[model samples]
Target: PRWRNIFKSNATFWWSFLSGIAQLLYVFGYLGAIRLTFMPTAYKTTHYRQPLLDHNGIDILRIESGYVACIFRMPSYDPSLPDVWQTDALISISIALTLFLPAVAIIVICSLLILRKLRIAKSTDISPQMRATQHQLLK
Candidate 1:
């Protein structure tokens, strides 16, 4: 019984460690997926609006037209912005579906196994011969 207790404690410790590692891996895998899928792209000014010549004598093109210029020049490539919010949402859903839930399932299975072992140990009756053998082995 004493040795079983010791082994049980050790098993619990190792199971906790493994679960921690699994959780860390899940988080990293999710982050990696987001990084790979929605990578940042270079901003393009022309995509938003046509450049206009300044009223000054200088020939430099200006991007300061009215509301149309404002509408055209808005940044749309970054994933964190409202323009690309759907991309971020899709990446999050995909990672959760593929990686995070599986890790949680593994942790749950380990917990259930430990509970089953404890229940069996409590319900079993030790015979005298087995108790004597266990005592002798401990000595």
Candidate 2:
């Protein structure tokens, strides 16, 4: 029974660590996706799966180039030009907050809970008989 209780406390600690790791992974995943979309990496091939056509029925083209560079390459240097990828930065930030913040919160809360549980368990009065038995067992 004593061993079982100790196991439970250790389990709580591990669960908190796992939750934090998951959140951190999610934040990185979102950032990586955005970077791949708007800010393509040199390693990831320029080509990714794209829809055959736009919503307006216009065909989409796949060029051997990065999207960010392509946007700036347009002639006339139109300062007022609308960007299709403008929302990506916002999405990245949102993902970072959603995944990373909650994970951190969960880790902190769980750790506090476990610590409280430990303190309470330790502060409980031990019966003289149980203490004697434990002492004999240790000897």
Candidate 3:
């Protein structure tokens, strides 16, 4: 009963905590999208041809390249270039959002709703039988 008063007193605080968790999720999601979208992929070039100087002229080597290291040299990679820092940051953020943030949000929202319903019951003039039934059903 005393603790019920505490929950009643802190309804706004619980709501704010839930809002904060949601806002954290929003911020992390936005940052993760940015990191994933604008990140550079290794450049690719196809059918690369060049002129060769011999006694009279020109030749070409048709090639496919992943990254152009220089005007004369192009390197190919099996996968795109890696950015360890960005990748790690994104992964850490995703874990925090997907795992930690949702759990916190759920706890805060459930607590807030329970407290709000309890406060509503307290404010309303309900019969003792009704209160017992509410507690039994809810708990």
Candidate 4:
């Protein structure tokens, strides 16, 4: 006997459209959240007092109020610190997590569900064909 599960729809276009909308929403929400909340100057700087003149050749210290005046970032005039590389390092890790996390979660959930169904399929109620396939698989 065929497994007539209505969990599947005969309409391919509807599923495709739904999938496209879901993907677009995920991308838009992820990017929009990042854009809305991300601060360009979201870093701590170590203050240094120059004795006489330093490498950039000015004997004064400068500080500006942190603000996101516009989307485009102005060139940073602050002295480079060791922590600058940490931001760059986090970029790859963040990208990989964001891209694969949902996919991995879905795969894990589906695999668990399949395992559960297989466990129950050992019951005597299922079709002989499926039972035969089950026996073959167990072998």
Note each model's CA RMSD in angstroms.
Answer: 13.4, 10.4, 12.9, 12.3
lDDT of 2 at 9: 56
TM-score of each: 0.41, 0.44, 0.31, 0.32
lDDT of 4: 0.46
State the lDDT of candidate 2 residue by residue for 19-65, as single tens digits.
66776687677667556445544422222222212222322233543
lDDT of 4 by residue, 50-122 (tens): 3113433332333353332222222234657322233432553465457556745554555565555557655
What lDDT score is found at residue 135 in candidate 4?
A: 88
Instruction: Go through the candidates in order and give each one's C-alpha lDDT.
Output: 0.57, 0.55, 0.52, 0.46
Candidate ordering by TM-score (highest first): 2, 1, 4, 3
| Candidate 3 residue-pair clash tally | 0
Clashes of each: 1, 0, 0, 0
Instruction: Give per-residue CA lDDT, model 1, range 58-139, as digits (tens).
Output: 2223424321111212335455875523444465557756897889987898787778777876557578888788889999
**Candidate 3 local lDDT, 22-120, one digit each (tens):** 766767775665444333223211222321223213223322322212122223333485422334445545654576556666767767786777798
Candidate 1 Cα deviation (angstroms), residue 128: 11
Over 4 Å off, model 2: 1-14, 17-76, 79-85, 125-139
TM-score of 3: 0.31
| 2 or 4, greater by lDDT | 2
lDDT at position 114, candidate 1? 72
- Candidate No. with top TM-score: 2
